[model samples]
Each structure stands twice: as C-alpha cells, then as structure tokens.
Target: MKVLHFLSFFGLIASLSLEAAPKKENRKPNLIKPSETSQTSIENSFPKPKDQYQIRLIMENDAFGGFSDQYYTNGSRLEFNMKAGESNPTRRVLGYWNDLFITPTQSTKYLQGFSLGQEFYTPTNIEKADVSYGDRPYASRAYFGNSLTTATEDTSITTELELGMIGPSVGGKSAQMNFHNFIGSPTPQGWDTQIPNSYSGALRTDVRKFYHRFFGTQYNLNLGNIQADASFGLIFRFGNVDKTPGPGSSALQPGPPILHEDGTGYWYFYVNPGGTFQFYNATIQGLMGSDKSYKTQNRNTAFSNWDNYLNNPTQEAGEREIQYRALAEDNGKNSLQRYILFNEFLVNGTSNPYNIGLNYLLFNNIFNGAEDIEKSTRLFLLNNLAEQWDQIPDNARALAIYSIFRPEGGKLPPQIRLYSYEVLSQFILDPKQREVLLQLLRNEIEFRDEKTYVADLKRAVGFIKVGFVSVSNAGFLFGVHYNYQTIDFQSGKGLPQQHQWLGFQLGKVF
Candidate 1:
C-alpha cells in the first residue's frame, strides 16, 4: 500500500510538470519567397511593422513615361520622395510627398505630393513671336504611384492614369487643330435657309476659339519572366458654340457629329500630314466627325493668315471671296455659300511631326529576373507611337537603342560582338541617352552577383518599383526597384528545398 501511494505521488508530479511547459503558437511569420522579387524584392514574408516611413531620392531618365528610351529623353527627372503612415502594401493607407523637378521641356519649380495631386503650367513665354500657335502650359509631364508590390508575390498588375504628352513622338513634333465654335449648328434646312445668323451671311462662322483636353491610362503587368505594358485614352474639345445656327441662338449646334460628355461637345478630327481634307477654311459640322462644307463671309481674310504662295489656279484666293466654286440650287441665299477644295498638306520630313491615336501598346518588355537565369527579350510592334514603327529613320532608332543599351564608361561589353564603337558613335545623340545606358551597365557590373541584371533591364525601360522585407526579425530592410522582375518557385526554380539550401543570414535592420 505504501509503495502504491509513492508511485501515485510521482505520477501526479510528472503530470504537473508536463502541464506547466509553454505551448508553441500555431501562427508563424510569413517569409518572402525567392520568386516574388528580383534581387531587390523584400526579403521578409511577414508584414512590415506599422507606421514606418521611407524616403527615396529618385533621379531617372526616360523610363517612367513608357518603355522606350526616346519617350522622355528631352529632360531628366529629379524627385525627392517620401512615404508616411501605414507601410502595408495590402492596406496602403499612406500619404506621399514629392518635390519633382525636370529641366527644359516641362520644368516644375516647386515641391509636389499626393496631397497636391497634380499641378498645371500655363504659357508664360508669350512674348516670343514664334512661340508656336498653340503653345500652352501643361501639367502631365511626370507621374508618381506606389513603388512596392501591391499584389501577392506570385503576380502583379499595376494601372496608372496620366495626361499630357503620353509618349514621345517618333520622328518629330505632331500637331492637332481644335476648333471651338460659339454658335449653334446649322438648322434642319441648313445655314443657307437661315437668312440672318448671329454672324449673318458670314458662312460657317460658328467657331470662336480653340482649346483641348486629353487623358490617358497605362497598364503594366508582371508574370514571371514576362512583363507587358499598354496604354489607351481619349482627347476632347469644348467650344462656346450652341446646337442651332442663326443670330442670338444659345442652343448647341444640331448636327450629325456624335456629341459626348453628357452631349456637351465632341471630338473634331485627328490630323496628320498624310491625311485628306475636302475643304480649307470651311465649317466642318455634320453627323460624321469630318463634315466638309464651305460657308465663309470673308475668304481673303481667311487665306491672308496663310501664305500667299499657296494661292494657285486650282486653289486660288480672293479678298473675302470664295475660292472654290459655289454649290448650285441656292434659294437666293447670300447668307451661306458652299465650296470644295480637295487638299492634303505635304509634311516636311526634316521637320519633327507627331501622330495621335486613340490607343497604343507599341512597346513592352519580357525578361526573367532570376539571378541565375538567362535574360529575356524586348518586344516591339510594327506600330509604336501610333505611327509605322519602321517609319522612324534607322539612324534615329539606332541612336535610341544605343542610348538604352550602352554600358558604363560608354563601353560595350567585350562579350557583345556586334557594332564597334567607331561605327555606332557617328550619329549625334542627346546627353540623357547615356544615363539609361549607364543604368543598364550598373546591373551587369554591380548586381550580377545578386543575379538581377534582367531586373535592371526592366528598370532601364521605365518600370519603377521598390519593396522591403525584414531580415531575420531584427529590423526592417528595404530596397527600391525600378521595375518588377522576379522569379517564382513553382515555375523557375521549383520548391526551394530541392535546389536552394536552407541558410542563415545575420544582419541588422535599417
């Protein structure tokens, strides 16, 4: 009996000891997978500590606007950026502050931020006589957004809304003419029947002034070794004109052209050198966007603004006189006259021209950012900048390519066997051209050990991104990435335990 009692006492003690021991929590901190980022992706898998702040000084060349090196070479951007409030990408409740400056084209003298949204610039150099007929200030030169991985590690899709010059003109400057009319559209019987419109007998004199509004959206996608980008947008024009024609009419013009934006206005027409026109100095208002009809009170005054050399037997001119032959069956209506002049302008090749389109996906990049993998290729479509991609002079395109690919010290890697420096250096190029080349070289020179050269290439084409992950629970560690280029375990390397050995790294957080 005494032996049994002792055994019972010992068992109770053992049970108490087992119950006293601590329990291991079921939750484990998330760790970063190798495939989520190139060399620069956050190393930690768990969410970063809350309320952390990050500031970065950004000096980039010609990559943010689009993938092409030629898109923004006219100016280099220098931005002082700061992000505050929450640091979680899943719930990015943060505010941004930035002081972005650009030289030459569209320069900003003040600091900017998320609170500021965007700022606009007006034409201040109006004193210059040749300031270009439609030279106005613009606010859409630069764009800013999250530089971190907003989506889960395996895939990411980022969309950006932008305005102003969406991308660079391939060969030269492009022009679009916007006409804003203040008068209403012609009556059902047409302006001929309306004896006395506001500018009576003035002929298609509804146009008062001209101004334009443009908006664009760009989308970037990252899927393992492939990255794709595309953009689309609309251009709008608003005038003081009402639907009806004739004196003192406040209603907008009633016509064939489809009105938009709550039926307030419509897109006039897209113009290029090769485009055709049926009339000049004529009122274009019909169901279709391009309705060519002539109604002019003074023809000579209209042609006077233009060069006299254009006057010829076929396309002649007179003082406030109709140049083209008048239409028949007029009801003694001196109020309106219709003339036709089939014409198209011969654009000068030497002069820089522009091509405007409703949408564009001309360029994108696809590459594997894995340190050990081979580099991917760049993709180009037949139509970039909404124009024939091949139309750009080979020399010009060569210069652009050189600017993007030339390595550090302006040196081509010895491994590259094509095109010697002597032959490639012949064409004159912009100074900003070399900056991108330098960035591309930096990847080969600095990050080769990290195996992030492909990521560098993505960044060279204007994919800006940055992320942070903790380094072994000490503190947070982070690095900014220009573009998204990361490998995935399921595809590239498979499960890490198979190829990548477990290892321990000792480091302090920044």
Candidate 2:
C-alpha cells in the first residue's frame, strides 16, 4: 500500500510541472523611459538650433544585476563608464567615440539611428589590463517608428586552442597515440557524466515586431567548439482584451508586455480574443529580446521523447524485425542548451547526421516478446554503467531509469512490469536500419564477467549479466539469470538477503 501511494504521488507531480500555459506579449512604458520623453522634444523647445551638446546618463537595477550608461550627443563621439563589478571600485570603460565616426549617414531612415560609434572600437580596459581593444564585438541597433527595428550583433566568446605537431615518427618509431577519455554513469542521483564546458561565440541577426502579440526572430551562428544548431519558437498571449497584462498585470492598467533577462524588449501592444502570433524571435525584435520560455518549451518537448514508451505494435508475428545501430555516438557537446541533445542535433540539422554513424548490433526490440528481451538488455546496460558492476538495488531503482528507452522508468517502484516496446521501436525506422542498435540493449557488450569469459571466449566477450530480487508471500523471489528482476529495499542485500550479485548466484530462491 505504501508503494502504491508513493507511485500515485510521483505520477501527479510529473503531470503538473510539465504542462504549458498560454502566454501573451506587448510594449510597456519601460522601453522608452517616461523621463526621457523630455529629451525627444528638446530640439524643438529652443528658438534657433544653437551649438548645444546633449549629455544623458541612465542607471538601472534588477533581479539579475545592474548597469549604468552615459551618452553624449555630438559629432565628436561619446564615452561609456560601466559599473559591472559593483562591489569593487575597479570599474571598466566599455567604449570611447571619435565623434560618432562609424554611425551610418543621417538619411538612412528606419535604420538611420543604428551605428557602431567610434567609441565602440576603443580597447576595453579592466583592472588596468586590456582584454579587448577597439573591438566592439557588441552589435548595433536602430529603432524605426511604428514598432519596428533592425539590429545585428555578435555574442561570441573565443577560446584559444593549441594543438600538437606531428609526433616523432622519423622512421616508424612504433605507431602509438595518447588520448584522454571521460565517461560517466547515470544514477538517479543526477548526471554521472562529467561534461567539460567550452567557450562559445555567435553572430546574431534580428528583426523586431512590436504591436499586438509582440513577435520576433533571431539567428545565431555560433563558432568554436560549441555545437551548431538553428531553432525557432515563440510565446503568445491568449486572453480577453480586458484581462490585465502578464503575471505582473494590475487591475487599473492593461497588462505589461513580456520582459527578457535584459531590459530590452520586442513586444506587441494589446491582444484580445481571436489574436494569434506565430513567428520568429529574431524577426521584429533586436538580437537581445525576451523569449526565455521559447527555448525551454522546445527542450521540454525533446525531453518528452527521450524516454522509452511502452509501444506494443499490432503487427502480425513472423514479420521482419527492425534493428538500429549507432555506428558511433557523436558524443560531442555544444553551446545552446538545446544543442547538447541528440535529437536536436539530428532534427535541426540541414543534413542528416545519422545518415551514416557507428554502432554495431543485430535485431530490434520490436517482437511480441521484445519486452522480455529489452528488460533483459536494460539490466545489462544499467549494471555495466554502475559504480559497482552489479544490478541496481531496489532503493536506487529510480536512479536507474536515467538511461534512454523507458517511459514508465521514471523513479518508479519495482513492483511494475513493462507492457510495451512497440511504441519505441517505430522510432528506429526499417528492419535493416535497426541492426547494430545494440547500444540501447547491448550497452554493456564491451564488458563481461569471469563466467562469461570461461563460457565462450569469442561470443561471450561482449555480454554483461545482472541479478534481480522481488518480495512475495514466499519471503523473496530471486532469479540468477538476466531478465525482468527485482531487489528489495530497506534490506541492504539483494533478493533473498544473501547474495544479490550476479555470476556467483544461479537459479531462484523460490
């Protein structure tokens, strides 16, 4: 009964947090500071336009952090003082202008305001050290009246790489190569894989749309070791016009437009029923705009398919069975959080990366009795990938479900038996293609125990064996061979509470 109630609770939590709610967007007063309204009309306030220069300073604070900027209006150029490292007095000078020299001509309407001022090229000095000079990697933008603008920016961080020259092979000095290898096991505790992060830089282009249902699109060309990917997504509002803005809406005023990590925004004004927005984030908004959820929603959708689904196909028996082989898993990593995923790398690719890969195996887990076959294979993968080469204990079973191909595998109690593997097999494609897909079933093929070694040197070299224990009226149910097996929690030992490890034990306790 305790296990039953716990399973029910786990199911409830998954349903609640994974669902998405409708979102809307629009422009608010924050974009154009209310106080800055006076400056827009300053030219007209005076009788004759004399030689008067304008100097403006702004300061802002928010949850993430704060920034201060100073702007001067003159052909002579502008200077900027940034207070990023606030705790310390060592502030940095971001830019210095040589009289707005690099700005486009005055008549470039719609985009005339955008320019990389001369000051942008000056070296960035921090802590009396010059990290970057006159290299304004930051892009420029110009606002066009009527809720539109165009901008381009490069948000790339470069990493220096030093490779080795051809080694000493003057006359065949014995061919030998040195390489570093990193592998991890996935436990319920978390990602056991130790992934080293890399520096990333990207070129961004954008177009802003800000009227109703604020929309935009952005394209990032990330350089360096980071993964390359192109993704499109959006956040739209759906509600009665009279309803307040977003989560921060008030009773008296219309809801506020959606906001991004940065104060900048690409927003739609008022959106009522019958309103719809389907576009790119880079379209109307500048490169840096608000659309955090867009990326996450896409990631979530991918996560939805990461696990195995109990799919029982209604196909007749004796039909051709499919096989999938990962000639080699492109375990490379990339920048965009989404790019790190396998599906994203495949689905978002212009050319199929999976067209030719390296994985070796025969047969797909699609047959009528595939459940038994897969359950058998799953234990092997789990044991081989574990800290100690043995089957997962009853208590750590939730952690065992971290690998792919099991939907009902999430942190569930071991009383369960998988019902379907068909739903998952459809994803692998044709029968021949399914061959060599042993990575999912045969993950531990590279490993073996003493019994396996003594059985048959060649054939048994690549197979792994695991154990299982379950509790019933018989005190305990134990199985020596690899199959859908179980172990009891609370009791530190395997089933029977005597010997839980495989290879050494044979037959069942019952």
Candidate 3:
C-alpha cells in the first residue's frame, strides 16, 4: 500500500510536467556533416522539425535502482536516456510533439519499451493478458488506471509469516492446536495483502479456534473478518468443539443421571463423543410389575434399586437369584424400555415466550406387536404427555409423552421422555422495534426404538404435573397439565372433557 501511495505521488508530478512542458519551437542542434557518404546522407536527410525548443527538468525517484539527477535535451535525450540500459534517469525531461511522427523514432521506441516495463508492477488480480492498445510507456508512468484497477501497482513488496497457539489450554498438542494461513491480495491503492491478527481460547472441555481464510461468508462487508477469496459472497464460521472420552466412559462417568419421577424407569442422557454423538434417546422399553418381590430381567427387586450403585448382592441369594434367573430367561430382552414421539411442540405463539411441549412415544397401530403391552405403555405415556408437554420452552406445544413400567422391578411406572428444540427468539417489540440478538438451539436425536415390548398396565393411575422450566436464552416454559385416572379400572373409559388443565406457567417477557 505504501508503494502504491509513493507511485501515486510520482504520478501527480509526472502528469503535471507533461501538461506544462513548453510546446512551441526548438533550436536546431549544431552538427558537422559526416565526412563519408553513408553517414552524410543519413545525417542530412533527418526530417527537419518545424519548431524546436529548449527542454529542461530535474527529478528524483527511489523507484529506479538508484537515486540521482542529470541534464537532458533533444539531441542528448535520444543519445543517452533513450539508449538501452541508460534510461535510468538521474533526472531528465524530454519534449513531446503534436506531429506523431515528429517525435523521433528513438523517442517513440523508448516510450514503448518504458511503458512495458511498468507492466511488471501491474496488480495480479487484473490480468495483463487483458491489456491492449499497446500503450507508450510515456502515456502513464504513474500507472494511475492500473492502480485503481488492482493492488499490484507497487514496485516494492514485503511479506511476513506467522504461527501461534489456539484453543482451551495454550499448549503444543493439547486443545490449543491450530493451523497457519498466508494471504496475497491487493489494497485499494495497490499493494500486497497479509494476515494482520489472530487469537484463541478454551472453555472447559471445549476447544475454540479463530483465523482468517481468504474467502469466507461475509459479502466482504467486514474485510478483516473473513478470507481474501471471500470478497463477493464469503462466509467464515467460528467453531468450538469438546473432547470426547473413550467408549463406555458414559457407563462409567455419565455427566448427570436422569431419574424417573416414578420408580419404574431410570433415564440418563450420556454425553459421549468418542466416534458419534449418541443421544441414548427414548427407545421403546417394558418390564412386568407385580407384588411377591417385583420380577424383571429375571431379577427380584429385593435388593438392586439405586440408580448409581449397580453393585448389588453378588451371591445371588433369595428373590435376587430368582429375579436374576427370570431376567436371564427372558433371552436378554429389553423389557423395560421407552419410545420416542416425533412431533413435540414447544412455545406455540409469536408473543408467548412461556410455551408448552411434550416428548412422546407415538405408537404405530400397525407395529404395536402385543396389543396388551402396547396399550398399557400408551396409556402410561398419555398421562406423562398431558402433564409435561408445553411446559418446557413456554412457546411451543407437545403432542404426547412416553412412559415405561417394569412390574418385575417393583418400580412405579415412570415418565422417561420429553421433547425440546433450540429455537431463535425475539425480545419484546414496541409494536415496531426490530430484534438484535440471535439464539440457536439444536435438538438432536440420541436414542431410538430398537427392541420389542411386553407386559400390561395393572390399573390406570392419573396425576397432574406442576412445573416451570427457565431455559437459558429463550425464556421460561410453563405448564399446568392433568390426565384422567381410571375410576372404573375394568373396562377403561373416560369422557374427553374429563381431562383438566391442572397447572399453568408464566413466561419471560424479555
């Protein structure tokens, strides 16, 4: 860029000199005729100028190989400045003529050659292949047009290389590892471009990176943010990712365990990124419920109940052995499982931040293997959906919920699934004000149904759920939900209106 600036300054002076050079007449150069015919004819036959004038100018430039000034005139201009390898002007100004041919052939040739030399200074973005009309070097020593067209107008260029650490912990191969990038571009005035700045940081187990790519997604609005190739329509993304422990790490150190409100099922969302992100989502599950020591997985709930303490009596004594035998007899089947419902609603309206949502196991009537097992599971799920849906994000809605019960485990039927999503939100509008902040919440599937279900609902029990969720950015989700419990257990039946909105939640206005 500095080179471009210097060139422009020279351009200004050269332009002014061409404009002010005297253009009237010139005094003839005193010359002795060559003694011989060969030289005599050429010297005498030279076209006599209609007018000749004295030309003189002093100049200084750092562009050439050196810095110096010298005298020059019509006769001397062609003999010295126009001579090959001699045009490195110490300081010289030549005359211009209106008659195209009047400018001696030597001068014409010199200008043409000089102009071509300037091409070396042409900016790379603008292809030299595109230039035409073979201009005389004298036409524009300033290269003003080329400068405006490309950043390559400079005669001198400088480049610098850089390397640095990035990410969470600032170490060699820890999280703070990154790659280096170099850029070659032009500035508005004409000059090469290079990387100006960079940085990195780590957050907990996550590592983050930041650097400029030549072309990113910015439309070039903010030049410094993206890559050089990104001049027109570019995009650059700031990415931060976490390190995943090896497999079975979750089974070992699951971040936080999710317990079912009821005693039946234990829900846990494992954060494992070893190879892929498995949500461990709601998979259809089932277990039989009964008295004489609840039976499940051939295990009697006589001892193993704690969600974390998996080390139960190893001796396999009393009902424990019986439960184990029963569980072992089931052919290692997934009897205590939960299912997922595809469409769960969260926050429903434009202004209502406090919305409702649900996580359900939408039973496919066609695939319901055992009607008895499927119905019992579906009923347990309906009650859960009615209470938990539309109560998380506050703005959405929920269609249903899925619940699983294992009778053999001596645990109560528990609600195990809930649906939620990351949604963009807007703050309160004054009937007209626009929003500023943008929020993104991604709801990914971690679990799916992979097994057959079995068992039956002993008797339908109804309950109301009262809870409010204050989500980080979207606001608080509220719900007042209730479901019908069977007054008549035998032939289960209830009026549609019998359901009630037992609870409700207020939302965050901001």
TM-score of each: 0.19, 0.19, 0.14
Q: Provide C-alpha RMSD values for all models, in order.
A: 30.2, 32.0, 35.2
Q: Global lDDT of each model?
A: 0.20, 0.20, 0.20
Model 3, C-alpha of 66: deviation from truth (Å)? 72
lDDT for 100 in candidate 2 is: 23
Per-residue CA lDDT of model 1 for 162-243, tens digit only, reads 2212111211111100000122211111111111111101111111111222211122222111112221212122223322
Q: Ten-residue segment with the worst summed lDDT in candidate 3?
A: 70-79
How would the candidate models be sorted by TM-score, starting from the highest? 1, 2, 3
Number of colliding residue pairs in model 3: 72
lDDT per residue (tens digit) for residues 1-510 in model 2: 655565557557745754653444763444766346445445444456222111111111110111111010011111111112223221111111111212323321111111111111000111111011111111111111111111112111111111111111111111100100111111111001001112223222221222343322222221212212232222233322211121111110001111111222222232111111212212111122222212110111111222232132334211212111121111111112222232333223333222111000011111110111245556555444454424323422333342224432122111211111222222444554333232332322122100010000011111112222222232221212221111111111111211111111111111
- Candidate 1 accuracy as lDDT: 0.20
Residue 500, candidate 2: Cα error in Å is 42
